[model samples]
Target: PTSVSSRVYVTIAAALVAQLHAAVATLKPFVWQWDSNDGAPAWLENAVRPAPAGAHNTPIGLLRRDPRTLSILWEDGHRDDFDVRDLRLACHCALCVEEMSGRKLRDPQTVRADVSPRQIVSVGNYAIGFDWNDGHNSGIHSFNDLRAMGERAAAQSVENV
Candidate 1:
């Protein structure tokens, strides 16, 4: 009887050990090695790469808009001025453009000259989102894209002169 009881105890212990092993194995995917320095997880190190050169240098000082223009003062002392109408017309959101085909759905001519942003918000430190007075708000304009557009406009002005 003692030998039988010992066998039953061993079986229960083996089953518990197996269950613990299974639970650990199941949670292996969810377990992450945390880093102490930056407080980010080890798995996220490869997943989250550093932003591009100028990408991190977003508007530091001020982002302001008048009735006619939207202005961004970058961290690197670069000022970008965008015409309100031009900026509204350049919105590349799915509602404004076809996502797959990249065709413009919203008529550029339909946007009024007096068009302005009703609200502006930052998206994850990488992009700026705008809610236009015309009730269009799906667009998320990246800082990189905005800087490029500003540079392009500056080049065009120089060329015209």
Candidate 2:
């Protein structure tokens, strides 16, 4: 006697749990490297090498998300890549949710290279908050951010070229 809406919710809940399990299973510590796509130029990507560990005096280092693997790499050689799918489902941001207008930012790929985070601080167990270099840390983009950027690379490719 489950309503259609309830069934959908249950299915989504199960998927989210599975993704969380998968992300936890792959957690680790290591330095990460990523290959940029059209939106992000190769040179720009290379230029973004990890900063030194404890570089921020706040126990913070570079946070690089690999598009292919959704892995996170820190400058201090600590690495952990979460499930991109899950991260997208949990994108908690005013812009992403559009609480004011009841709209969602559909083009997560709009993230520009300039969106580089100036600093990163571990949030509660669920997320790592960011202070974007471009002052756009309001959106704590998870692995899904990387995929969106990669997918929109074609349109953003012009920036690279």
Candidate 3:
């Protein structure tokens, strides 16, 4: 009786483990958000990174006063300004970034200096999608990635100043 029960327990444990993995896979997209700290827990470190804690990184307000810039106010009181043209050029859509090699296919010269967003839409809760006047709308830039981009741009600006 013990031998049979142990075998059943092993099968049940395997099924439970598989279910847990599936559940984690569903939440992987949320967990893999870009983080300022640039690391993750040991269990998920290699597979899924992390992002800002909850509402701290959520966009509270989005402002586009002109075609030149898009400003976002985060829930944590951080404001990030993004250049319209640069955002267009930095699109990670399949058309902008190669699907297989991950190389950037967009040539800076191909993007006009005044290229701007034709429409802006939210992608669920985690991303902002842009439709460019230049006729590309496939890229959906996540808020996490955008935050990182803004941070990099600010760093460069500071270096120049």
Candidate 4:
């Protein structure tokens, strides 16, 4: 009887977790696109930007990822660094939540190594979902989120200046 009860609990827990993932997935946007001058990948642009001198500092390239490391390139020729693990921890998907409660969840620092490379899943009107290598299939990051982070970082840079 005890074993049966335990099994029941496990089943319920799994169901609850599934429900959470579904909920988060719903928040994902569609049609996220980037215009790289001449259609270059965003990371490549980022990797090459920082090396150039006396160019437009505005990012000429921007990267988005579901599981892959996204990078950006400044028109003036400087690259910005982005970590894939950090991106995953910020997954806005419901499955990313705690099982017992449908609250949001983040990647624990210890589990960062498990964060997977992302494949661009679907492009939404303004967002994109990445398929992570670690089997995390949720977390669609919007362009707005990306731009906001960049703006915040830029603001911090000004503070440092």
Candidate 5:
């Protein structure tokens, strides 16, 4: 019943609406909540600062040892060794730690000494993910955190000496 030009305009309008919907869906994950109390975006509260110059957090190589151990060689000529049990205890995921309060939900005692990773995969350039033999896989351990652990271990060793 509509003229040809009107039908073409309606089709174009529908396509534009569809494109707008798609764009919103793609950007949904990046949308941040505005906090009225703090007058800042919610994501800004936990924004990670850039690492200082000459401070390397990237791992050059990761090696898994028998009986549940991981060795990470860093770009800064430092190597970090971790037992599977220690890795599990150090998980910083929301499931393991309460995001709001930063309270640990996972008890370290419950993670057995013999617990091993079923699989280890890189989450992205920033973190490594572990699927544990005990059926836990929610944690993504960032390179910065792993490096800090290594630094802490080194400090502890020096203190004990």
Candidate 6:
């Protein structure tokens, strides 16, 4: 009797899962498009609009708001504003971060509040390298990581509000 009841429960769960899958299959696919500046494709725009790979990581502009702030404008129209000190402290260079153990070698508390970049340079098309005012410049930050950080910061700000 117990075995029969367990089999019935399993059958009901499987039927419900099949129904859920069928419902999901009827839903449309989409991409969080920034804009169709590239012009719409021949296919139904939403149906064929594959998410632009690395679109957010492609920087179109970089601005220095002051000695303490940096702003990056991405190809997807997303802007990332980073405090210079914070960005400097987050460097992942071998000197700052132990390459073998993945331990943090640089203490954030030791980084001065006024720490900033003396220069920012494009490392090919995929990343940016910085010449920090404190003479630390080995770290190259990938645009993908930058975009992710910006997204997280934006979400956090919204949550805090």
lDDT of 5 by residue, 1-161 (tens): 29999999999999998875433110011111111112211222121233236446856556554455677766545668887688899998888999999999988888877787666666656777777778888998888899999899899999999
Tell me the spans in candidate 3 whose CA falls farther than 4 Å from its real position.
Answer: 1-55
Give the alpha carbon lDDT tens digit for every residue of 5-91 in model 4.
899999999999887543311212223232222332333342332333323333445555433456755443544556667667767
Position 54, candidate 4: lDDT: 27
**CA deviation > 4 Å runs, candidate 2:** 1-70, 73-91, 100-102, 105-111, 141-161
Tell me how many residue pairs clash in candidate 4. Answer: 22
Residues 65-120 of candidate 3: C-alpha lDDT, one tens digit per residue: 45586776655556788888888888888888999999999889989887876667
lDDT of each prediction vs. the true structure? Answer: 0.63, 0.43, 0.66, 0.54, 0.66, 0.64
Predicted candidate 6 versus true structure: per-residue lDDT over 3-122, tens digit per residue: 998999999999998875433111122221112212211222222222266344655555565556667766555668988777777788899999999899987888887776666666
Query: Clashes in model 2: which pairs?
Result: 28-79, 29-78, 29-79, 30-77, 30-78, 30-79, 31-77, 71-81
The TM-score that candidate 4 achieves is 0.46
Per-residue lDDT for 102-157 in model 2, tens only? Answer: 67664666545333434444443234554544445575654334334444544566
Q: How high is the lDDT of residue 91 in model 6? A: 82
1-161, model 1: which lDDT tens digit per residue?
Answer: 36998999999999998875433110011111111112211111111223346443455433344457666666445677888778889899888899999999988779987787666655665676777778888898877788889999999999999
Which sections of candidate 1 miss by over 4 Å? Answer: 1-57
Displacement of the residue 12 alpha carbon in candidate 1, Å: 58
- Give the worst 10-residue stretch by lDDT in candidate 6: 24-33
Total backbone collisions for each predicted model: 0, 8, 0, 22, 0, 0
* Candidate 4 lDDT trough over 10 residues, lowest sum: 24-33
